[model samples]
Target: MVPGIYRPRAVDRTLDRYRRSFSAIAIEGAKGVGKTATARQRAATVFKLDEPEALAIVQADHRRVLDARPPVLVDEWQRHPPIWDAIRNADDDGAAPGTFLLTGSADPRDAPAHTGAGRIARVRLRPLSLAERLDAPPTVSLAGLLAGDRPALDGDSDVDLERYVDEILLGGFPGLRRYEGQTHRAQLGSYLDLVVEKDFPQLGQRVRNPDALRRWMTAYAAATATTASFEKIRRATTSNDGDEPARTTVIPYRDALRRLYVLDPVPAWRPAAGSLGELGDAEKHHLVDPALAARLVRATKGRLLDGASSGPAIPRDGTQLGALFESLVTLSVRAYVSAAEAAEPEVRHLRTHRGEHEVDLIVEREDGDVLLIEVKLTAVPDDRDVAHLNWLAGRLGDQVIDRVIVTTGRAAYRRPDGVAVVPAALLGP
Candidate 1:
C-alpha cells in the first residue's frame, strides 16, 4: 500500500491477457481504487491528463495520443474527452493489439462519439477483496464452483469475525491500507467529502446543499445489502418537520453518484428462462466499499460487533454488523467473479416477489448455471441460515451448479447436504 510499493491486483492478470488481443482496454473504477497503478504496469507511453500542464497539452492536440507508443496510458483521460474518439479512430486504422490503455475515475460528461464495443474493451477495478488483502493465498476457487464439478472445499482461514470487522473498517482501498484509527476513519470521511465537494460538481451535478446529499448518502448506506425501496431510502432522509426532497431532485443526485462510481448497487436476479416465478426487481444498495458504508453511518468495530444499529433508520432484516458483512462479502465475490473465467459470470442477489426466498449472492453463468451463495456473519451457519440456498438449489435443480455459504468460519468444508461452506478469506477466482 506504500506509494512506491505496488501490490498485485486481480485485474493485473486480466490486463496482461487482454492486452495481447484487444487494441484498447479501458480500466474504469471509482477514485483511489488503483486504476493508474495497475494500468501503468502495461503502459509504455503515459499521459497523466490530471495534471494541469498535461491537460493543457492534451487539450491542444488530442490526436497526439494516437501516435504514442504501444500500450499508451491516458491517466484520468476524462480531462480531455475527445481522446477516446481519437483512440477509436486509430483502432479503425488497424492499430495493433495493446495499442492503448485508458484509465479514468469517472466517465466524461461529454459522451464518447462511439460505443467502442468492437474497438475497445473495459476492465473494472474495485477496492481490494478479502482474499486480496490477506497474507495467504485462497484455496477455494469461485471459478471451480462455477464449473459445476462440485470440487472439494479444503482450506483453513485465520480470518474471524473480529478480523472481518477490521476489514470493514479498514476497507479494500490500496492506498488507504496504511492508515489506522482516527486517521483511517477521517481519511474515509474525507474521501466521501471529496465526492461531494469536487466529484459531483465535476460530473456537472450542482450540490446546492452538501449536507442534504451527505444525509441521503448516509441513509443509503444504512440500507446496505437490502432491496429497500428508493422511496423508503428517501423517506429515511426526511427532516423532523415532515418535509422530504422531491423525486425529481433526488433522481439526479442518484444518477450523478452512480456516474461517479460512488454507488455500487447489486441488481436483483431474474432467471432468463423464466423458470423461477416472479422475482423481485429491486436492487440491493451498496457503496463502492463497505468501509465507506461504515464511515457514512459512523459504524465502529465495537458497535458493529456488539450488534448495535443506528443512523437514518432504514428498515432491514439483520443487525448492522450483518448487513455490512454482507456488503463486504458482496465486494469480495464481485472482485473474484470479475477475475473468474466462467464466461460472463454475473454477481447478483435473488429475492422472490413475496419475499419467501432470498439469497445474498448469485453467480449466474452465461449458460444459465447458477452458483447460489449465502452470507452469514457467524462462523457457523445452521440449517435455518442456508434454507434459502437449499430452496434455490431445489428450484434450479441441475442449473444450480453449486450452493455455498460464505461465512467467517475458520475452515472451508462441504456439508453432508452437498453444500459448500467457505470462509470468506479462503475464496478466490
Candidate 2:
C-alpha cells in the first residue's frame, strides 16, 4: 500500500543492501505493513499478482517474470506460489543479481516446492519502529549502545505516559498512520475482523468458529508481554462444537495467525555458549504491534491511562499500559537490531528457570556480549526497578555491556549504578 508519502523504515537499508548482491529478495510481513511500498521503491517492474488481470497474466506463463527489467517486483508472490519456483528456476538459468523482489503477506500452507535455500534471500518488513514513526529525532542509537562502548546517553522527550498510551493504541502499522479518531479505530477493528473472516480462509485454513478465533485472539492479546501458555489462552474461548477447544483446532488458528504475521512471539533467550545458568525456554507472547494487542483487548486511551485491565484475564506482572509499553519498546528494539549492519544480532527475552529474575529484552551480539534491557512505565530508575538489571550485570560481569530501562519519561540518562534510563521515543536503531 503506497500511501502518498514514503516514510523510511529500518528494513529499507537491509533490503537495499541485499538487493545489490542477491537476485531475489523476498520482503515478508503482515498485511498493510508497507511490504509493497518498500519493494516498489527498488523495483524496475512490478507484478501486481493480487489484481485479477495481473494474476491471469502471471498464471498464464510464470516465465514472463524473466522478461521484466532488473529488480522485477513480484508483489504478493504467495498469490501464486509457482512464482517462487519460477523465480528460482530463472536464478538457475543465469538470472543476474538484483533481478527479483518478492513481497508476501501470507505464507501459504502449500509453500513453494523449493525452500529457496541459497537462492532467495528473505527480509522481514515489520511495522514502523519508534524512530521510523519520526516522533522525535532519535537521540540514542541502539547500534551505538550495542557496540559495547559506554556511549554518552543524553536526550529529552516530551512524550509522557499519556502520549505513549495513545501511541500504543494507535499502533505502528504505516498504512493506518493517516487515519484518525473514529475512522482509525474502525480500520483497526476491521483489520482484526478481516483476519478472522477473510484472511483465515484465504490461507486455505477453515475457521469452524470465527467467534472462538476472535476470542482466542483477544485472549492472546491479553497475554501480551507474558509467557501465558497456549492452553491457558485456548481455554479463554469455546468452540462451536462445545467443550474446550481441541489442540487440533487451536494449533491451526495459531499457525494461521503466525503465517499471517499477526502473532509475533519473542522466543526465549538461549545463550550460544557459557550458559546463562538454566534459562526458561517459554516464549513471550506479543502481537505484531502492541496497538493490535491494545485493540484486541479494547484498551481505549482512557482505559489504558486509568490502568484498567481489559479483555480476557491472563496472568501478567503489571498494568495494561505497562505491558503494551514494553511491547512498544520490544517492536522498536527488534526493528533497530534487524537493521543493524553489525555482526548478526538478535532480540530475545530472558527469564530464569525458577522465575526469580527476568529481563524484558536481551540484545545479544555474535560474540556472546549482551545488552540487557528492562522496560518500565515510569521515568526514573529506582533501586527496586534496577534490581534485576543489577543482578544480571553482576552475574554476567563483562558480558553485560549495557543495562537499560526503557521508559515513557521526559529525559534519558544513566543511574549511578550504570543502568541507563531512556525514553521510548528517544531510542532508535
Candidate 1 lDDT, tens digit per residue, 1-429? 566688888767778777888899999999999898888888899999978998888888876777777778999988788888888888899999998999988876696968789888888898998888898999999888888899998989888789989989999988888998999888998999999999998888898878778888998999998889999988888877876877786788899888888899999888877878999999989999999999988988988878998688888898999999999889888888878653558888999998998998898888877899999987888999889999888887888889999988999998889889999899987
- Candidate maximizing TM-score: 1
lDDT of each: 0.87, 0.87
- Quickly count the clashes in candidate 2: 0
TM-scores vs. true structure, each candidate:
0.98, 0.96
What lDDT does candidate 1 reach at residue 141? 90
In model 2, residue pairs whose N, Cα or C atoms come closer than 3 Å (at least 3 residues apart or on different chains), thus clashing, are none
**What C-alpha lDDT, on a 0 to 100 scale, does residue 149 get in candidate 1?**
93
The list of candidate 2 runs beyond 4 A from truth reads 1-3, 238-243, 273-275
For model 2 the local lDDT of residue 374 reads 94
Question: What clash pairs does model 1 have?
Answer: none
